[model samples]
Target chain A: MNAHDLIKEAIAEKGKFDSVYWIACGGSMIDLIPAHELLQREATTFTSYIYTAREFDIMRPRRLGEKSLVIACSHSGNTPEVVEGCEIALAAGATVIAQTDNAGSKIDSGKWTTWVYPWGEGVPQAEVPAGISLSLAAELLDQQEGYVDLADMYAGIAEMDKILPPAREKVNAELGDRFAKLCQEHEFFYILGSGPNFSQTYGFAICSLMEMQWQHCSYIHSAEYFHGPFEATQDGVFYFLQMGSSECRAMDERALAFLKTHTDTLMVLDAKEYGMEAVPASVRAYLDPVLFYAMNCELRAARGKVFDHDPDFRRYMGVVEY
Target chain B: MNAHDLIKEAIAEKGKFDSVYWIACGGSMIDLIPAHELLQREATTFTSYIYTAREFDIMRPRRLGEKSLVIACSHSGNTPEVVEGCEIALAAGATVIAQTDNAGSKIDSGKWTTWVYPWGEGVPQAEVPAGISLSLAAELLDQQEGYVDLADMYAGIAEMDKILPPAREKVNAELGDRFAKLCQEHEFFYILGSGPNFSQTYGFAICSLMEMQWQHCSYIHSAEYFHGPFEATQDGVFYFLQMGSSECRAMDERALAFLKTHTDTLMVLDAKEYGMEAVPASVRAYLDPVLFYAMNCELRAARGKVFDHDPDFRRYMGVVEY
Candidate 1:
């Protein structure tokens, strides 16, 4: 079933929900952020939260009961913490919507509504985990409390499918080699982003740069830049700033202006410079993270080639037990 | 007025509130986190959130109306974004509780309820910004929805006043020189903490190390360490882990075990090892951040002496305009 239909069915079955929780780990947790942000921005009657799976299990929020709706994701569908969280939610009589790329895994158990989204080569933009989660969030918001921009958000998702592929290629052709060269030259980096696009900033810092490339990095919120992290800004430091087209864009603009004067090695990936203009202005900010995610993936792939290290290679994860 | 009396008066004036927002920037923002976490963990009817002041102003949550209580802080009481946030909250018909160390500053205007907390030498633990915020949160939760641990939390606060001074001095006497040496040897470090203690980890990395000492750093959530940042752990890397006596202690323990195996330079400050045994176990977890904060201040002061960089010194903060 499609994301919207699945969410509709869940709402219909549950009758009412006072809270929605997005639970996952690592990249999966990061992927659900835009959806959580959407609910935070749009939902009035209902509250939303994003939790690292294990912490959710340990904290066991008192509000996680019959009136709660949990949307959890695990790409492998067997992440122990996520599966446990699904079980915890189910035991609490909360409706659970589980999304995964791998089917028939532990998380695919028929106890909850299971969503299998496309992954790997040639996957449409709307079929990715983030897309499915976002669509579900928009639908839930529309059904629960009328979202005026619901139609625009749907159109934006469709526009992403058409524009993201070419945008990724264009970014690769224009800046891939330069980004790769910078990656080779610098061993550490500070990444900045705000609003929904912070998911991309965080994901790139942790998953791609630190985990995949074995580099050290810190991801700072653009809004918090002037507060403390900006003091670390100076020449000879590597910085990558992700500029989004959102209300929070002012925060990014301020950080960009400061970085321009302070740092010589600053790389900026602005969503507006890409093909995001085709997306509806009402929903453009929500889709900015999707554009940033695709661009980062392409750039990271280039860095992998330059450094002679496969992005998929890991020394500790999966190979060692904790 | 005392925090509890002020919160009670505000609740009486407002009649009812369904949500609480803690908004501030930099260390002030970090200080509010424990209170927000306390509400998240204990409050059943009221939802809680922490937001950077500018982001809160830009993304004005739809829920910020008559049914909302906003607790905002700015140390100097003249932070532009925080002052603006208080105005926005007041305009939205929300009860605004403004906390600051300074009097008669913009944030101290009589438009909203202003709270002046103690700062500088020999301030009582219960009168600090974080202590007041946490007390306000506890009082609100107790009066609104019956927090069973309210009395115990108060007891914990009083215990903190009796214990924190000596605890800070002991930590300094025991680990000061070594921590300073580590700071001088390593230019970049990873600080890890879980649950409420994550506030100290973040505040130390951004405020003390990066902002004041001009060192590079990343603050990783203990729960998220294994997810991605663990790959960056190696022999030469420096790591400081804060272990708390909370349900989320398991997360910190796991990270500690792995860090011990991978890194040669690791410093750990466990709340259990400190003099927190005197505090009631029921409220010990909530007060762990307080202990960590005090210990961090002492250690950072030692590092400041060694590096000849005053913790109060800033390169850009008040020196330049954004």
Candidate 2:
């Protein structure tokens, strides 16, 4: 079976339980933080974690009894931490669900329920796997009964490829000017979001970590912007507020009110203003933030005009070693 | 009433509650973060927060009911947020306990149990009201059974005073050299801690904000250190770890181990190594980290002896008004 079908079955089959722990390193666990945030609000113990293999071996949580689900996600399947975490979780009596890119990889040898994604046509095999793996794990934990329509998720994946080509060209045209101006400036950029978009707050830091390459960037909830930090919002501070649904709308309003209090640098990206060249609203603002963030982050990267040139793309954070 | 007696009475009265929500801003809140770390583990929902009066007016938790306690702390009893938060909590039916240094300040106007500290001789009366106020708050919170012993805490506080005189001299003496080396060499410094010290990790940022005074700084928990940024610990990096009890002990070990791995630029101040100087292990290594931090922060102001003649005392990131 294809990677997509395998993932769908695992999402459909996992029984409802008392606790859910999603374990993986970096993006594997990061993509699921929003899902866990939603799940935790439902009064269940839910956690999404990122750890190296050696650290995982020394500090694995106890109990994976009948009511527990341990979702081990690793796009490469060979990632040391994800494999070890899967092994440890299974030995502790927890039900393991492994999402891997390569079906034949050793990660498939674990006792957990396995899901695999194959390299799709024309799409780079590496990126598609992590995104697909995460989408599968999110589907299982999304908890909205009508939301399990796997076909819809698969269909939505096409939205990015169809629209991104034009957005890329449009951004590339203006990127050089923006990058020059940004490089000349001595200021800090602050990204603000609220509610479900709170998960996307991590996006700002990760983008800085992986792309724009600035350590002075920070992301805070929109409501928190009004606190003392607001006083620091001089012309030197660049503000980016996520203007999607989620509860971010209300926070967006508050943020707008705050911006009105001063004549400074506040950039608001209202997705509604962009019109629906994207997906449907039924996707929920919580989930939509990621899509909106991917677009927003892409724009930022294009404006910065920085991209990896290395053929082997060495991760700045290094290999996921134990 | 004497500070110790009033603190004991307040604790005896608050022992009936299962959870607490401590509220303050700036120095008042920074002091409480260390204590709340212990309280959070001992209770069901112990959460302490720092917020401005404006933010409190908006998203203050509604109808606290009888399930919690709100300890509104302000060294001066004049901080607008603490006074307003105390009033809001009282209105919401939660028991509000006010810890302050002034008996006639605005916070005293709230309908909550109050404990005030008398300004001591020689110490700048206005500079550290929150320190004494927090000591009182800690005593009250510890009165609730086997959490923390008040006598031991005071003894530890007293021991800290003795340890400070000599360490303070030594560090202050080296301030010029340290400042010159840091400013001339490093682009940034990352302050780290775990468990109890994690609560005060922000204190390092606050000090860097007040002193360093132009250098960029970031703080993170030790568990989070390994997640991504630890890889950056090359010869150019400067790291400071706050040594405290609880997970601080384990994190200290991990940090020391990490230092051995990447030797060039790591500087660790392990409390365990302090030996008899940091007496009364019952004192909870938590508070000791803060005491040492307060002194180390002085190095920021001494900056290569450049600012010795003209101190930049302007409040940059301190208390703000809407």
Candidate 3:
């Protein structure tokens, strides 16, 4: 089955269950947040548990009577913590599902049910696995709002595809050199997302990890920025604000104003000014910002491969087992 | 005035009012959290609003009341945000009390009431003002708790004074080098706390903005970690877990075990291991952790200054309002 159908089926199955708990680490868990919100709004308590897979065995909540469904994700199924978590949850009498790139890997080796996806030979490196997996899990959890209609999501992806050549040119030709120059001295990034784009911020953060670059990113409410943290924004702070929604218009303006006054290194993607307005609102929320993120991932990967020659490269680092 | 007397006078004068809202940035806000808990326990809903000074005017909550109190804090008395918040609160019909340092800064300039402390040149720059302000605020809001034989608190602080210096030496001597080295490449830190320390984690996270060096630092409950974000620890995500009580002890252990398998960097501070046994068991619930926190603050500041400094540092570049 295609990725979309698989997710829809999972969501349908999850909807049939009375209680659902999602457990995953930072990178994979973020994709589930949007759907988790939908579940909560639908009156499903929808608790999210984020732990190291190894901790899963000890921290698993006790109420595992038949109705609970546990969904775990790891791009590589070999992570030790995830493996341990599955063993503990199954022993505790809860049904477990493993979502991974390699279906036959050890992550799905035990009593846990498994979902697998194809990523071709592109090394499954970069952003695709996480995006697909999270989008799938979100669907399984029945979390898609009207905002992510399947047709529109695909169309949005298509829209992003169209912009890729020019966007790449604009970013590489102008922004890339600037980013590379800045990143050389700066070891961190603070990515801010507003409205629906916050999910993209979470996703973008995860991809950074996948690319094997150590960078910090935060997903904050635009409105909350005016609180004290704004004071911390200095020359070293790189602020990435999503300039799409009217609800967050004030936040974008405030961030713009702060960067104008307080700090010097401000990497902003003024989506409106960039002619990115052609993308539909719903899909663009998930897709457009990623265009910038994709470039970031490429830059970092090239940096690591060409510049750093990180010894841990290429060898999958083979999933971490708890 | 002595800390105890200053608080008593402030509370006595401010208590006559119908409501109180503690306004502050991160560290400044934490001093009031414990007291707020006491007040909230007493069923006093003071409409607490925590925001940056600039946003205070923009996102100010509903007018607290004609007799409401706005307790504003700034260690320097010069932090632009607190000064602005004080102005806004005073203009909004709320009584403004400035908990700050020195006599001449803008935060202390207007019709607002001011509680100033003599600068402690002996203490570290960022902390001296904060410690005094926090101690005073704590004493003020919980005068009953503060003076309920503060001879014990004095002893506790004194004992803490003795214990922390050595403990800081021990942790720094043993783990400091490792942490500094790890931090050089691993840029993200996810800190976890549970139960009473949940708010403590929140406050500590605010203080961590210093070390974040623009990295993302997030703190969540131990229980919540298992649900969604746990899946991301495939290659062993780095994390810090704060173990406060026996209840959350398992979670801490689980985290350590998981980190052992999954992520590259992990630090777990278990109070049981920290010789907190010297603290009176009766008050250990609060004193042990609070005292440890006092040390953590010291250690973090030392570490930030020593290792986390951006070679080139600048402030307030993101966006700010005057």
Candidate 4:
């Protein structure tokens, strides 16, 4: 059976996987957060725990055992912490699922899984990094939400595929120049979100700005605005709010109302405002992160051209004995 | 019973607490992290969760119920989020343990237990807000490690009290002037820590600087250094590393090694490096945050003088509407 079928079969099986442990770090951890949040909303019988890859390596959570299902990911297929986690989970007699950018890399020794995205015709289908997270979420949801929900999600994905081009074109043509112009003008940025969209808020702040553009940015939760982080807010401060139609939307609305009063440079990327016509209302909340990613790329695309630095190149990633 | 004995009795009662829910925010949340971490380390039967106070108010975890013990704190006893969290957790039938500087504060209502620090008797006996967290931790540990272990911690606390005078005197006499000289040198500062000390590291960064002193700072986890925040590290960048004992020490060591190699301005606050002779090995690991707080105050003492900012004054704390 294929990876999706295998995952569904595992979920369908009785008396298995009483607990789900997600072992991931950095980018992988960010991606898993949405699925983790969704699982909390949907799966009542499943006790879920998420640990940073190194913490998992060190703590070896007591509940992880024969009845546990460990889902770990590393796009590079050789992230040291993920590899160690997989090895330890396998040794503990827990079922292991590995997600990697390449199939034959170090992360492939466990239950094999891959996420393939369809490329244009005449070009081979591309296996994208971190795509497995989305597939993993959908497969798990297939058990609770039924195959029809999965079908609806796919239709939504296809619908997004159709409208994404024009959306990107419009975003680039209109907001791209504006983002590029305003990007450097702000010394620091704070990105805020709640619910599943929180992952994008964090990913954009850390990945797109900190790691990619070497800019100063911090991600704050919408539920935490009145806390200490808001002390830094001022009239001219820039903030990007990734608002979605999740259960925690009220939290974001409250935060946005406060930020709008405090700062003039507030940008709200509402998933509802975007064209999501084909997405069923029942499953729309789950797609917020996916839609947020599409919107986040616009800022990334604009900043990539404006800045001289390449996001891929790192000074100390694999250099000099780290 | 005394507070310590009462807590121990609560823990000993059969099936009274199946889980622990820590409801806190910002500085309060940071103070609670060490206790939360220690609880996770010691409590095997207990399922524990730490949430920002507002998040706890909005999301209210399904696990929080009659069988859960919710520990929530606010120094001033008037943080709106903590008040809401206390109300919600009490309404949900969870036992509430409230920590505050004042016993008569609003958080003491509705079947709530309180931890009140002595603020009188000339020069205040140094009402360290984080001290409440450590005491709370010791109370919980009283169940697992017994009263003898808690006694050892109290002895360590007394020992630190003896040396703390000299430490503070030296910090104020010698380092105070130097810090004042270099107060405005850096644009932004990063605070790093691991293990129990992580809480103090976060509290010092957010509470002492951002909220109180009106400065910019960010607290990054030591294990997360390589992920995104490390991209901003450079030759002249300053980072204060609150290295400590406990299980996660190795994680901080790795991050410190990298920071030392890259930056000449690395400040390492090692509890062992300082005069901690009176502190016993059995309880030394837990004193990391306590010791780190002492060292952090030196910086605060210095900065408060140089910047013409009182750490106690606020622009919009209880004085204004949210």
Candidate 5:
């Protein structure tokens, strides 16, 4: 059985949980954002908290308990802190579910009560973890409060896989050339998103721009944009608007209007603008980050045009021992 | 009375809570990080959730109830979302404590059942909200599980207000001259911190550099630094390590070690290096953010020497409609 089936089975045997401790590290930590927002927005039966692995180990919020369902993610499967988080959850009598890119690596050892690997392998412009993240959100919400009786969220996954590639090519063609030039010219950029797209805003800013090309950027949520980050607005400061159909769309629209007057440097990629005719309206918002990630691949390629920098280029990352 | 005494009185009347909802916006939102971390580490009786005011207003987690204490903060006390967050918590039958700098602003206009302004009004290099944040943490921890007495926390704050001015002058004389040259030289910087200091790192990045001079910076938490930001480290990448005495110190030390090998552009300001002659050892870690904030005064002043940009220098902030 897959992740959805496994979770359903776990709930059946281990019983319903009172809370959830969503813990992971780095890019893997970003995977928890959508499911968390969904549960926070929809589910009332259970409460959820997302923590960085070391934060979990050190702080140990009292919310984690026997009735807590801990979802731990690590793409590499060898991240030390993530492995430690899994161990900590297990010791606290919480059920541990590990999501990893590698099936038999360190995180996939006997410690995890159940494990899941990447989905949608080799699909153009797709993030396997993001696909799983959306499906997991749908399934959990479906089971919660009987909102919808989804057989599992695999149907939503099938819909996404079918429609996303065509949309990816179209978005790439439309926005890729323009964004690449902006990337070459601008010294600073702020990627903004809200709700479900929050983690993706952070991921694209750090993982794609800073990590991939050594650019300077920050990920600011649209809802909080007016508070502090909006102060950074000037003619030279660029804003990458990652638009989605989440509940916070109104907030994004508000921020965009404000940005238009202060700075002309804006690159918007609204999933609502894309052609995902096959995916239902019910689940489209939950997958916007996946759609945005697909669009980002082209932008990454565009940066490849101006500079000969590799995403793996680093003096200290994997090269030095500390 | 001060914030601690105010909370104690409110707790006496409203009764103790089993959970905490920490709500605020921007700088005020960052102020809650230290208290949240301390409570998460020490208190097993009360669970805590830190949310941006708008997030708390929108999400309305199922856990919030009559048995919950909601701490809402804003400096101006006129931020719309903060007012709405307090309204939401009040409607949920939760006790609300408003922390604001303004005495009679909208957030202070007959809305909050309890409120607090700064204690030491004219102290040099002191953040009123941060001092309150530490005191709140101590009170919450003391009330939960009968942990260590926290009268020492107040004594530390008094020491900080007294000895910090002289130390600030010293640091300004020693590091200020040198750091100003670096600030003038480098265009990009990554301010890294963890646990209690993480919020201040972000505050210094957004409030000081980005807002004050439109300089580029990203505040990376030590736990999340290794994930993506670590990839940005090379010969020219600058890192400002705002070291505080917290449980996450080891993680920050590890990152600092790796950064030393990779980049020549590294700036470290550890609280341990500063002298607080009167502060007791038991509560010094809780007040490290306060120490760092004091040191930041010199850093902010150093930026003043290199350029003339006001914190209020903006094209859109408070000058136009959104």
Candidate 6:
């Protein structure tokens, strides 16, 4: 079934839901963030949350029951924690929608509905994990509370299919060499982002930079940077800012202005600079994270070439058990 | 009014509420996290969230209305962002309970209710910001969905009043010199914690270590460390784990065990090792963060004395305009 149909069926089976939970781990969890942010910003009838799968399984929120809708993702569909979370949600009689790139894996063993998206080359933008999750959220919001810009959000997703490739190429051509140089020069960095875009900032810092390249980094919310993290700013410190095209842009701009003045080693990737005018303004904020995700992948690849470290190399991750 | 009485009055005036938002910034924001976690874990009738004041003010959730309850804190009560959030909540017709150390400050200028907690020496444990916030959450849970362990929670708070002073003294005597030495030896550290204790982990890393002492640090959720951040863990890297006495303690222990193998420079502050045996097991987890907060203050002070950097010293906080 399509994403919308799956959401509609889930709602039909449950009758109504007062809460929605997005559960996953690592980059999968990060991919679900913008969708959770959508519900947080728009849905008045229901509350939503993003949880790391292991924490969700351990904490076991008391609200996870028949009236709850849980949307979970695991790239391999085999992450033990996410699979366990799906089982728990199913046991609570919640409507569970499991999204995965791997079909017929452990996650598919559950009684919940499954949506499989393509993982490799030439895949449609909407077929990616983030796109599918956002579509599910938008569909649920529309079915439950009537999202006014649901059509526009779909249009934004379509526009992404056309714009993201060029956008990634542009990022590689414009910022790749500089990013690679910076990676070579700095041993550590502070990444700043706000609103939905902070998910990409975190993914790029922890999953890409730290996990892939073994770089030390910290991701700070643009607004919260002013509170305490900004105190660590100085001439020698490195800062990378991901500027968003949303209501929270003010916070990002504030951080950018401060970083520009305080540090010489500051880099910024502003979504507005990329060609996103084809996307609707109403849905542009939600799409900013998608664009940044593509750009981050390009930048990571560039850094990998310069450092001679494969972005896919892992020291412990599938290689050894914790 | 007392914290519980204030919550009761707010609910009485509102008639009913489906959501609660805890809004603040910096340490004030961190202090509210345990309360937010309490609702997330126990209250099935209502949903709750923690938001940085600026983000809450800007994003302005559509759910903030007559059926919404907002509890905000600002240490001095004049934090512009939090004051703005209180005003926004009031304007939306949401019931607002504003907690502050300074009673007559700007937050009190709103039509919302205000609860004043003492800030200085000899303050009872239950009269502090974290304690008051937790009490408000517990009261709301008890009134809304009947929290079974409400009395035990209060008893735990009373027990804290007796145990915390000696706990702080013990932390200073046992770990002070070693922590100071580590601070001098290491230029950066990763602070790890899970469940509600992660709030203290974040508060210590960002607010105390980085903001006050100009140290570089990143706060990693213990469960999340295995996902990506663990790849950056190695022998020369420093790690400080805050072990909780709760369901999520398993995650902390997992991270601790892995860190012990991967890095020689690791420190752990385990709540179970302290004198928390007298606190009810059911409520002990909720108070773990409180104990860790006090312990962190002691450790920060020890480092401060070693480096001669006053814990209150700030390069930018109130000194410069952002």
Give me the candidate number with maximum DockQ: 6
Ranking by DockQ: 6, 1, 5, 4, 2, 3
Better of 1 and 5 by TM-score: 1
DockQ (model 3, Cα): 0.09
lDDT, candidates in the order shown: 0.87, 0.53, 0.53, 0.68, 0.73, 0.87
Q: Write the per-residue lDDT of candidate 1 for residues A206-304, one digit (tens) a residue.
A: 888888888788899998888888988889898999988767689999999999999999998888888888888877778888888888789889898
Candidate 5 C-alpha lDDT tens digits along B208-293: 67766567778888878887778777777778887666556777887888888888999888776677435676665566777776
After TM-score superposition, the amount by which residue B122's alpha carbon in candidate 2 deviates from its true location, in angstroms, is 7.1
TM-score of 2: 0.66
How much is B123 displaced in model 5, in angstroms?
Answer: 4.5
The residue-by-residue lDDT of candidate 5 on A162-242, one tens digit each, is 666677687667887888789788776788888677878888877777777777888887877777677778787888898
In DockQ, how does model 2 score against the reference complex?
Answer: 0.12
TM-score, per-candidate, Cα-based:
0.98, 0.66, 0.56, 0.84, 0.89, 0.98
Candidate 3 C-alpha lDDT tens digits along A168-287 = 566556565565566666655556655435555655554453335544445444544544346456666666665643233455666676666767877776666554566666444455
Per-residue lDDT tens digits for candidate 6, residues A86-165, read 99998998889898888899998748888878886578778888888889889989999999999999999988888888
lDDT of 2 by residue, A65-146 (tens): 5445676767678776678777877776667777777887878884667777554434632245334544544455444233
The residue-by-residue lDDT of candidate 4 on B215-245, one tens digit each, is 6666777877777777777787778777765
Model 6: per-residue lDDT, tens digit, B31-100? 9999898898887777798899999988888888888899999988899999999989888888888888
* Residue B267, model 3, lDDT: 75
lDDT of model 5 at residue B48? 71
Worst 10 residues of 3 chain B by lDDT: B40-49
Error of 6 at B307 (Å): 1.5
Better of 1 and 5 by DockQ: 1
Best of the two (4, 5) by DockQ: 5
Model 5 chain B: ten consecutive residues of lowest lDDT: B118-127
